[model samples]
Target: MDIANQAALVTGGASGLGAATARRLAAAGANVAILDRDAAQAKRMAGEIDGLAYACDVADAASAEQAVAQAAAAQGPARILVNCAGIGPAARIVGREGPMPLADFEAVIRINLIGTFNLLRLAAAAMIATEPQGPDGERGVIINTASVAAYEGQIGQAAYAASKGGIVALTIQAARELAARGVRVMTIAPGIMATPMLLGLPEQVQQSLGDSVPFPKRLGHPQEYADLVVSILTNPLLNGETIRLDGALRMPPR
Candidate 1:
């Protein structure tokens, strides 16, 4: 399907992978709408990319619905929805402080897994009405974000991994259910990417982390993730699959 002139929405578009994907979609001639909690930064990126920006909390159904509605109001129904709004705060199920706070685990699952579901549900509702495009009758495509932690979850990644694992489970089922609507669902499970969270760490710590990746010997660039987004959006055959963006980095149990 041609992305040129199509409407696209990217959640968590203020920074990190979401921001990169937004810029890439804009460059591909898509009319992009960026949704993020950071209104100022999202607005700034929107100005730079000539796209629309909305302040949104993906965990809240009402917030996401309103935000998606705002995007559709500005630029018809979005043909592409990329869910990148999530949090990854690591905590052990049982720690020196005793059991991890229930809130901590809930927060990760709420924002990471539930958040993806919120936006996708609303976006797909609107997209199902969109006139089919291309020979495949493609109405829309949804690309969900997961993490390598889902597979080789480190010691403190129980919450994050569970949330991501749910995303992986949802991909194929969502694709099956939405097949008749001409909507494709897919996921990307990235390894150790040099996201803002990691970049905020000490320089030596960052280097040590990068050295852990087997082949590339470095953390993934945001642009590389963005490139894959472009490929998945344009390729009609790719659906109901979780592509690991990790550079063969099967994490050690730390």
Candidate 2:
């Protein structure tokens, strides 16, 4: 679907890949709404892009519902919903510190897996209510963010990997269910991107991680991920699959 003049909602748009996607969508003439727990950062980014900023905890039903409603009120029902709000807390089931707390694992699942489904359901419902835009009767597109950890998780990433893996599974099923309604669903499993978390590591460590990539030999730029999102939005045929953006690097156990 053409992005121009359409409404789009990007979760976790305050920073990292979500921020880049928000800017790209806005530049393409979409009315963008940034949803993030960081209200100040969301406001700042929204100002830069001339979009709306909504403080939202995507895991909470009430918060997400309110944010989505507010966004629709400001722009229109979002035809493009991007789920990028997630957490990455590394922990093993059992460690020298003892078995991981059940709450810790549940917390990751709540924010990453359930949160994604929450937004998808709410946004798809809104999209379905809107009239179709293109020949495909395409009411909307939903893009989800997963991680390569879902494929090759390191030793300490059980919780993080499980959450992301659930997202990957949800993508195809969602696409299938929403297909009849002309709403597309896709997932992007990012490799090691040059986000704040990786940037916080020492330069040498970061370089070593980059070197692990078979090609490109570098961490992915947020803009690169954003570019793919634009492609997914524009190309209606690219649905029901999780594309890995990892440059062919299969992570080893840490």
Candidate 3:
């Protein structure tokens, strides 16, 4: 669909990939809304992009619903929903600390997998309400963020990998279910990127990570991910797919 003057909602839009995507959408003429748990940062990013800012917990049902409602009221129903709110804390399921805390496992699943679904369901329903636009009877498009860990998880990333795996697993089913409603669902499984989390590591570690990529031999940029999102939104044929944003790097077991 054309992003020009369209309503777009991006979760976790305060920083990293989400922030980059919000900026890109705004630049492409979409009226964007940034929904994030980090209220101050969300507002700051919104101000920078001249988009709406909403303090929302994507894992919370009521919070996501309220934020979507507010954004719709301001910009009309959001036809572009980007599910980017997630956390990645590394821990083995059974470590020296003994089996991981059940709560820790649950937390990752809650914030990453369930969070994506929450927004998908809510936003797709709203998209259904809007009249179909564009040639393919497209109501909207939903882009979810996953990770390369989902496919080749290292030793300390059991929970993180599981959460992301669920996201990748959801793509085809979600797209099929939402297809009749004119809402397309797709996912991006990104490799190591220069997100805030990775940027905080020591330079040597960062260089090592970057060098691990096969060809580019560098970390992926958030803007590159945003560019893919734009392509997915505009290309009517892309749906029910999980495109890997990795530089042909299949990770090794840690």
Candidate 4:
């Protein structure tokens, strides 16, 4: 769909991939909204993009609902929704500490999988209410972020991988269900990228991670992910799919 002048909502827009997406959408003439748990950062990013900001915990139903409503109040219902809120704490299912705390697993799932679903449902409802645009009867598009670990989870990534795996699994099902409503659903499973979480590691560790990619031999850029989002939105044929943003890298089990 044409992004110009359309309202776009991005979760976790304070930093990393979501932040990049917000900036790109704004540049493309979309009125953007940044929803994040970090209120200060969200506001800061919004200011940079001339967009709306909302303090939101994507995992919380009430918080997400309120944020979405507020965004719609300010910028009309969103024609684009990008779900980038998630956690990636690594822990073994059965480590020396004994089985990983059930709470740990639940936390990852809650923030990643359930959180994604929360915003998706709210945005989709609003999209369905909007008049369809273009000959394809397009209402809106939803883009979700997953991780390469969902397909090849390494040691100590049980919780993170499972949450992302759930997102990957949801892509086609959501797209197929929402198709009749003119809302498209898609997921991007990114390989190791220069996200703040990954960038915080030791220099050599970062280098090692970059070298592991099969081509380009470096970390993926958030902008590249945003670029793919643009591609998906504009290309009417792209739907109900999970595209790997990896550099042809199938990770080895660690």
What is candidate 3's lDDT per residue for 1-254, written digit by digit as tens?
89899999999999999999999999999999999999999999999999999999999999999999999999999999999999998888799989999999999999999999999999999999989987789999999999999999999898899999999999999999989999999999999999999999999999999999997999999999999999999999999999999999899997
Which lDDT value does model 3 have at 225? 96
Clashing residue pairs found in predicted model 4: none
For model 1 the local lDDT of residue 189 reads 96
Candidate 4 per-residue lDDT, tens place, 110-201, comes to 99999999999999999999999999999999999999999999999998998999999999999999999999999999998898988989
- lDDT against the true structure, per candidate, is 0.93, 0.95, 0.95, 0.95
Q: Using alpha carbons, what is the TM-score of model 3?
A: 0.99
The sequence of per-residue lDDT tens digits that candidate 2 reaches over residues 1-254 is: 99999999999999999999999999999999999999999999999999999999999999999999999998989999999999998888998899999999999999999999999999999999999877789999999999999899899899999999999999999999999999999999999999887999999999999999999999999999999999999999999999999899899888
Candidates in order, TM-scores: namely 0.98, 0.99, 0.99, 0.99
Deviating ranges (above 4 Å) for candidate 3? none
Q: Is candidate 1 or candidate 4 better by lDDT?
A: 4
Give the runs in model 2 whose Cα sits over 4 Å from its true position.
none
